[model samples]
Target: MDIDKLSIKKKRVMIYFIEAARRLMASEGVRALSIRGIAEIAGYNSATLYNYFDDLQHLTLFASMSYLRDYVSALSGNLKPPMSSLQRYRVIYETFDHFAFRSPEIFYNMFFGRQSAKLPEVVVQYYALFPEELKEHFPSVRKMLTQGDMYRRDEPIVEELVRDGFVRPENASPLSAVVPRLNQTYLHELVNGKDISPEEQHRRFIAVFDYLLETAK
Candidate 1:
């Protein structure tokens, strides 16, 4: 559908629904987001949301993508280049961690709201929402994941390391298997409501993530 052809009032209603969903996620967590709840908050009837979104998950995921835009926005004017692949890799996580800490609710919703840790279809849809300027903050491997299937999701990063001479060709499979585990650990810790300081969080992240990098060599 050409959303551009949508009437201004219709566009405004869609925005209201999406924003209402976001407000709910921020205040009451992802589980609180229901079509009726959103409609109530947005001053619309329950059935009205169907005109804007296909289902509750569609609106919820759409709302979640705004947090990603915020994450990308936070990285604006922040990345310093001339770093190694490993360094760039660290920056990516650091940038994400910083944003996640600052906006715990949204990041938790984005990373841990779904039952399956991976949101392949939603991730693919959200990637298209990123503006061109923020596109550079995305790692090459992330681009690969969004474009391709999630099986062997870490393969591209390992291949990049091999291309950079950071990992030997033969060690690719082992390294790929282990490197993504660090992310799993980090996300698990972040959403589990662990009572750790931001400093401590970074410390733990560096310890495990750096160890993975070391083992990759």
Candidate 2:
């Protein structure tokens, strides 16, 4: 549907359904999400939901995009200048850590749940709703929107580390590799129902990142 063509009533109903999905995911986890369940919460018949959304996946994706505001908010504040690329990289992970650990269910569904959709598509869709000011914080989105593939801003950061002699040229590949390992570890722990204290979480992330830095050198 052309969002511009949506009537006021339709827009309001869509918002309610998205909000209902958010509440259900927050309260019960992603496993509890269903078209019928969300429709019941929104006080509409299940079939009525199809008027606004393509399917349950479409609704879930829309609901998940709501949290990107927080991600952009967290990232935008910490980008003050004189910061190194390495420092910026750390800040990105730190912000993501706080976001994902706080809402693992939503994170999983938004990201890891559907193997069907690509990350670049999800990123484009989420940021389409981003306010203009917030959109300024994400340069990668422009490339992803144009190219229709995941764009890693960190790849250049790792390259810079090698060029600056912070990382040995031969070890540059693993520096990039380490970040996704850290991400996977976080998801693994969350999926296994293991909890780490905030302090430990901070310590572990820093430890792993530091190890990569040291080994790269």
Candidate 3:
């Protein structure tokens, strides 16, 4: 549903529901989410929640995004100018891993799970309803957060590498493709209880990423 088309009252109700879900996810984690639970916290019944969202997963996706605030906020400090495009990319991913590994399930569901395809639209809807959450980000950072496709999100950085002559034009696509896959490999394991510490996970990911960059050059 287009949130922009909704009545003011309806938009308010949806915010209530989304906020309730966010509270639950923050307090108890994503696995504890349920339609009844969200509706109860929102001061509505489950049927009313359906009026605002297609299903629990839909609501969960929006709720999970609340976790991204920390990641997005950290980028401002980590991605200072005078850094090369490749350095910026590395900092971005490292910053991402710092937050993502701590909440692997939420990150996995938001980016790699079945509902991930709907994320671009959901992100638009989310910001429409809560534009305040976006006001602090720089324009480039805003664009990066709103880009829902993991591959497309990283493609520009790879293209920057090509423009800067760090990578050949022919290698840009493959470099973009492999980087996300490599991250996903670690994320998938972490999500599945791989028994790795977040610190170890961060180190491993950067080591492998550095190796890939060397090979791509």
Candidate 4:
């Protein structure tokens, strides 16, 4: 549903559910989320949640995006002027690595989980419902955030590198394809692994990401 077209009361109800899910996620973490738990916290029954959301994963995705506020806010500071495309790309991913590693399961579910395909619509719906999170970013950064598909989001960056001669034209496609997958692999490990700290995970991801960039050049 187009969130803007929803009746005011319906939007309010949806916000209640989304905010409730966010509180649950913040307090107990992603894996602990349950429809009944969210509904109870929102002061509604589980069936009412279905009226506002497609399913548990749908609601979860909406709730998960609150975690990205830090990432979007930090990106503007890292992406200053007088930087090469390669440098800008590094800064963007490094900033992402810092935050994503902190909440691997949330990031993983948002981008790679079963409901991943609905991400584009969910992003539009999410920001429409909570425009404040979308407001702090610069125009370009905001564009990046709204790009729901991870591969499509990174393509333009790789294309810019190719245009600037930092990356070979022939290498652009492969780099774009491989980079997200590599990030996904590491993210999967971080989400499921028992002992690794976020700091270590970030370092390891950057090492591999930097190595891939070097080889792509």
Candidate 5:
């Protein structure tokens, strides 16, 4: 009967619905989701779901945002806070490794599922939610000024690397943008029906991830 108790219950219910939405999206795609489907998944009546979320689109975005938040956190993984820019780079790769290793399905969906994810707002928001595509990596080139990390000091050299096209901006998704194709082709060839070990898949993905990072570094 207490208002606080009621609020807590509502929050818990919303969390349930968010998770349900993700599974439903992955299994059936966003087009198949409806109030009835989500309600069934959440073990609630259709009208009950409306109490916590405005509508199906709102619910879809909430679920997508939750996934994105978790992803950003994962990118930081086990690193101490206040990571150096180079360390930050490692964290990003570490996040890539974690996702590639543990939940490639969700990781695959995060990018490939965008068209089917069905929340235009969520899609638009997440296009930029992509951290590697962010412009922040340009300034980070300065981190090379540090003695032994990724970058090197000499201004003319850095400039020549930049000028001769050796250095690509970090925001550039030279490899990432093509991941859908790579997955369709390379990764599928390696896995799909094969009895590939998880370690092998992890190694393959890390190798690809490292290859992309090598140029930017």
Candidate 6:
């Protein structure tokens, strides 16, 4: 296989698998994600998936990366002509909420329900939406760090580049990394598996999220 041809072949296989996974999750939920089932869904044998990925885990990871990329693109489209960094972040967040609600089976299956927490590099790069999509998530995060206000936020406020957005910080990541690093503080088992009331779960998760969102405001 020549390099270009090999890339094209791989791309088609990946797309087929992504569609299969999406259909399965749309109909049967994440638990429906078995190697056999995905193979069937893609009109190929399980062996084909092996050629593209080591196992079902990698396949699903790839699907998730593609999904997030499409997700950000779609949300960005629904926003005003050109949105600011904060605006872009907020739009994507709301889009996430909507997508989660509409496709509970698929969304839950891909996340929270998966045994893996491995976010692929490709996924991180495309949905960035900030200075660069890969680290676009950084600007909002860095913004949070620089501010010490109920909102007296101001470090480098200039509208000299990128049109709707500002030039990204020269010194970034020290504080903003904490935003994307939020999953580090979250505990799924404690919240999802326990006998706690709904209110309690809301209170706990909200508290964590509130602190984060508050700083952004």
lDDT winner: 3
Expressed as tens digits, the lDDT of each residue in 1-217 for candidate 3 is: 8888999999999999999999998788888999999999999989998887778888888887766666776875688789999899899899889988989988887777777778778888999999997887788668767765432458878889999988888888998888888888898899889998999999999999998888888
Task: Name the runs in model 4 displaced over 4 angstroms.
Answer: 132-151
Write model 2 residue lDDT over 1-217, tens digit each, in one string: 5555667687678778888998897788777999989999999999999987777877787777656556656666775577876776778778776787666666655556653254455454444443463356456434334353223535777887777778888888877876766775776577667777645666687787878788778
lDDT tens digits by residue: candidate 1, 26-107: 8888767888899999999999998866677667766876556555555433545677766666676777777766555556
After superposition, the stretches of candidate 5 with alpha carbons farther than 4 Å from their true spots are 1-16, 19-37, 41-61, 64-67, 77-87, 115-194, 211-217
lDDT (Cα, tens digit) per residue for candidate 4, span 166-204: 888889999999988888888889888748887887788
**52-124 in candidate 6: lDDT tens per residue?**
6656655565555435545545554565756665554445445554554444333443454452343433233
lDDT at 98, model 6:
50
Per-residue lDDT of 1-217 in model 5, one digit per residue for the tens?
1223456566567667877887887788656778888889988889988776667766666555545445544443445666554444445555544554344444444444443333334433333333343334333332321123111112333343344455565534444344335443433443344566556765676577556546565
Residue 61 displacement in candidate 5 (angstroms): 6.1
| Clashing pairs in model 3, backbone N/Cα/C closer than 3 A | none
lDDT of 5 at 31: 62
The collision pairs in model 6 are 128-133, 129-133, 130-136, 141-176
- Find the 10 residues in a row with the least total lDDT in model 3: 144-153
Off by over 4 Å in 6: 1-3, 7-18, 41-44, 61-70, 78-89, 100-174, 183-210, 213-217
Task: Report, for every candidate in turn, its global Cα lDDT versus the true structure.
Answer: 0.66, 0.68, 0.84, 0.83, 0.51, 0.48
Model 2 misplaced regions, further than 4 Å? 1-14, 26-31, 43-58, 115-153
Task: Assess every candidate by TM-score.
Answer: 0.68, 0.72, 0.88, 0.88, 0.43, 0.48
Instruction: Please provide the root mean square deviation of candidate 2 (C-alpha atoms, Å).
Output: 4.4
lDDT of 3 at 100: 85
Residue 189 error for model 4, in Å?
0.6
